[model samples]
Target: MRSGYSAAFKALLTRFAHDTSGAIALVWALASIVVVGMVGAAIDYSRTVNVKEEMAMELDGAVLAGARFLASSTDIDASKQHIVDTFTQTAALAIGDAADLKISPADVTINETEGKITATVKGQVQTAFMKVLGIETMNVSVTSQANYADKYLEIALVVDLTGSMKDPDGSGSTRIASLKTAAKALIDVLIPDETSDRVRISIIPYSQGVRLSSSDASAVTDGYSQRCVTERVGSERYTDAPYTSEFIGGGSGYMLGRTLYYMGYRLPDLIYDPEDVPEFYDRYGDGLGACPTEEVMPLTQNRKTLLDKIDAMSANGGTAGQTGIAWGWYTLSPNWNNLWPTDNEAVPYSNEETLKYMILMTDGEFNDVYKTIDITEKDCPGYYRRGCTSTTTKTWWYEHYNQTTDSSNRAKSLCTAMKASPANQGKGIAIYSVYFNPTSNAMAEATMRDCASSSRKFTYASNGQALTETFVKYAKEIQQLYLSR
Candidate 1:
């Protein structure tokens, strides 16, 4: 009887072990399902987040367009419909047939009294694997608001017209050509209808120096004949101080002599005979004559004038970016308003109703800087006696001119002061810098980076198309008034 009981117990133990193995297998199968479901949920969540982010961006764009339209449109219902239509089209392009995409005219609100437009977009993205976990769809909703503040804008487009701009961009087009096209497009958007007194643009094309009208140059420098001028020196170098006679002579002597030398004429005391001078002088090589032929256009509301100035731009000179930056500030400075036309005067820095912007664009380094020298009797004894008979002392004069600080440093200093003007209630000029450098010029990039108001205001373009796009983007941003969440 004991042996029979043992046999039965052993068989029962064997059956129990077999059942335990089957139970372990069933548990693992259930865990596998759970693991797969978790992974699928994670994927669906990621996709939903991406779609939502895209929707948010698209919504922001839609509202910006709506706000711009509302600024000009008198019909509120029509503007609202335009906003809805714009969203639908952009959504189709960005989200690609999102489930239950919904944007109606009611979703866009227009406040005429406040000059504001707000828009909302709602949609759902169908889930693939989350459906198994009872989440059939993920909802996405985004709202964007824009204010058409109607504030006046004073913009300076400081462009590089250096010799390198003659080089072909990545798209096989000259940089100057691309720049003109892009700049004209910007003018079109900002000063639409050519009758907008609310927006004024100044074109400052600079090379080794910025060109002024001959009369303006003379006025600023107390009879400096050259149309081009370099960076100012002394206490008011970076300030928007009125160009009075006291400050005008600080840098005028050097400019006067240099301009005369490059124009194939010598100073009255140095020249033996004025009739011997050539009518034209080749002013390349040493960058002495590296002044852009394109003269600066002061703040103007005329779209045609702005466009024409850009079209007439020709590139042939060294890069003097500091001069460009200085002129950019001057154009928007109220102190220099007297230099411009009465109707084109810049609004005061204290004016809360005006927004000032400077777009500083360059393709290469700030390699040119003006130097000053005091030539005395000892330096040129013959000048006091018989005067210089030939160009024998030209090279010597060039070498003796005292060099100033680094051009890049000067440019950055000007940029800093412009962005932190003491006069504008602590809110100064907004600077946007564009570096169109396909060659990856590190120093140029660094200088431009330092010049921008913020990281978001700096842009780099490696090709002609990209350069144009950057200009257009900044133009749109500048015209947007103000945007918020």
Candidate 2:
């Protein structure tokens, strides 16, 4: 009986041990499967999130690109296409250029609503782990918006239509023609508005002198005029001669115009007065005014008229950059129709709304200089050659006709005068200077650069295209600023 009981106990214990072993093995297997499944899902989920994030970033960049293109776009479909194409290209490049991630539409449409540019980018990003779960792709959609800046602009184009500009040799009929194209391009970018006259453009073409329209003469003063006299060779002593105009008092100084140099003569001088002569210098030659023989026109905005004048510009005169720059300053001056417009805030010219700026361009050095030389009985070189002689100069019989008293120094002085004008205090004006076909007159370049508001504003354009490009850029930049303001 004892042996049988012991055998039964051993059998029961063995059976219990086997059952526990099988149950433990099954539990271990289930736990391992759960851990593996969790890890796999985590990896897949993280990948999808990462790809979505990347897609979102790509879409954001696309919106900005699209908005820029849209700014100049005149049509909607074209703008939208540009946005989408950008998104597709960037999306592909971002993901190893994989075919899996792509904007099916390949075009994002942008709309301007309430003064904002808005765009939407849609694309599909293929998932790694999600694909194992039978989900091969995820859609990404993003929207972006950029606010528009100012819209009303006032633009002033300061161009160089000087004698040198008309040369086929200097810039090949290239300067004026390129100027026309660039000007037209700038005009096209004007983005006009009907709600309010949003943009106003003024064109100023200058060379040795700036020619103004007769109509604007009523608002202009003799000080800003680029006139002529019966100019001829002479020393600094006979520089201020009073000569009668071949035409009349319209202007008695600009006898042959800046082209006087080409005609083998000197620029005319103002008449000297005993009171006009300073110990060494005087502002307006004699305190009265220089004797001008050339036609002195005033500022003009008329398109056809201005264009015609520009077409007729011939290169023949010495570079009087001072007068050219002065005219530019005059065109931009708020004091045009007022004595002291800045102080009289109540009735200042409306043209002052835009920023005052000037672009001074020159190919040659300064040739024209005005100084008060009163040849009294004691200082007169000769009876007729002593005082201010209009028709001729002492040099006609004595010195070189085109002899300048240090032209380089004269250019520097003129530049300083323009920059230091009472009306241009605290840099009230922005200046852009160009050195086109410069001579050995190093001071000429220095004077222009020093007077400019920025180094970027100074340029050395070799050809006509470059010459026109400088001014055209100024016009466009001003146009942009004007429209924005």
Candidate 3:
């Protein structure tokens, strides 16, 4: 009996030792710890990502605000403090403050030469799950860069000084008044102050054509020898080449065979100053008064001078958009750099560092251009050697060969030339054409649209405010800021 009991007890102990249920329970307990850790880690990582995204957005706004503040504020320390304080407030509002969050004034860097501002925000997020594995926190960082580079800008304002510009549209407000206001506003925005050489502006007011000052005309002549000038001949008419003249002797300092240098000569009726029109009496009532005789202002950084020129502009001439386009291109072309003042010389066409722009405004269709026409001895009056007088006595002078089509075609050709691709004499000129005429002349609109670099570059101002708004819009675009990174 004692041997049987001993044998049964030994068998029972062997079965208990071979059992695997306890091992399975131990394995499940170990797996549970790892699973819980992974789940907590995912939750903590997601929270960190959210915080990082919020921090980045807030930091961008803070940097831009800082940059704008820096631009206006002279005190560097105050500006930097303001930037950091702004970031601190913005980030706290965006995400809960972490113990490691930090943004010092030294983190903000301003590079005036590069026209850039850089700001960085660094912080660490404490991880709940990761801390269990000996990890205390994970780093979170964001950086923002704002570029307000003062790019070298060369702007040509080709505005219509035509008599029609003086006429009040249905609104009872004159287009010329609106134009002056708009142009002055642009000048103010672009120049801001007179200290910077990064920007320069040239004014080319066009009527029957662009009026060259006596000095400019003489500059085109041989040693100031000639005064009588003619339009450009052959393919040279479409180019910005300086006018070439042959000296006709008489000590009269008269220049003949002079092709159109600066948009042929201004007509008689367009004379804004009485002192300027020596032959006003002869040409009075000749056609529609005359073209403007106002002197063109070359690229200049003087804010006062540019504003004064705009204010002094008067309305008195027929429309000649083609010549306006030509002079606009010439104003920004390096080929004609010698004609401008040394301080405002044009950069080379291949210069990628500079930007060239043309803003052409017109209130009427292009109607006048210099064309050779046959005139009889009686009508010639001998005082005029080649061109016809702006008078009814010689109606033949008014009717030049395809005057209407030719003038419009000339405008189109100039537009094409100005916007020509990288090839040819095309210098990547950005043309912005404004048609202030309220009336819908399909042909005129089409011509003006074709003149623009793109549809966005063309604007139609139905009223005075619209015109000003258009100019303000363009000013902002020309002097805009961007984010590089």
Top candidate when judged by lDDT against the true structure = 1
- Those runs of model 3 whose alpha carbons end farther than 4 Å from true positions after fitting are 1-107, 110-116, 120-144, 169-172, 221-231, 245-283, 286-289, 373-379, 382-402, 421-427, 483-485
Q: Estimate each model's TM-score.
A: 0.66, 0.50, 0.64
Model 1: per-residue lDDT, tens digit, 118-174?
A: 877776677778777688877777788888645667899999998889988878888
Error of 1 at 29 (Å): 49
How does residue 291 of candidate 3 score in lDDT? 38
Error of 3 at 186 (Å): 1.7
If both were scored by TM-score, which would come out higher, candidate 2 or candidate 3? Answer: 3
Mark the regions of model 2 whose C-alpha exceeds 4 Å error after superposition: 1-122, 125-132, 141-155, 168-199, 218-316, 337-353, 370-427, 438-441, 468-485
Q: List the residue pairs that clash in candidate 1.
A: none
User: Which segments of candidate 1 are over 4 A away from where they belong?
Assistant: 1-66, 69-113, 118-146, 245-279, 282-288, 376-405, 422-425, 481-485
Task: Give the whole-model CA lDDT for all candidates, comma-separated.
Answer: 0.72, 0.46, 0.65
Q: Which of candidates 1 and 3 is the stronger one according to lDDT?
A: 1
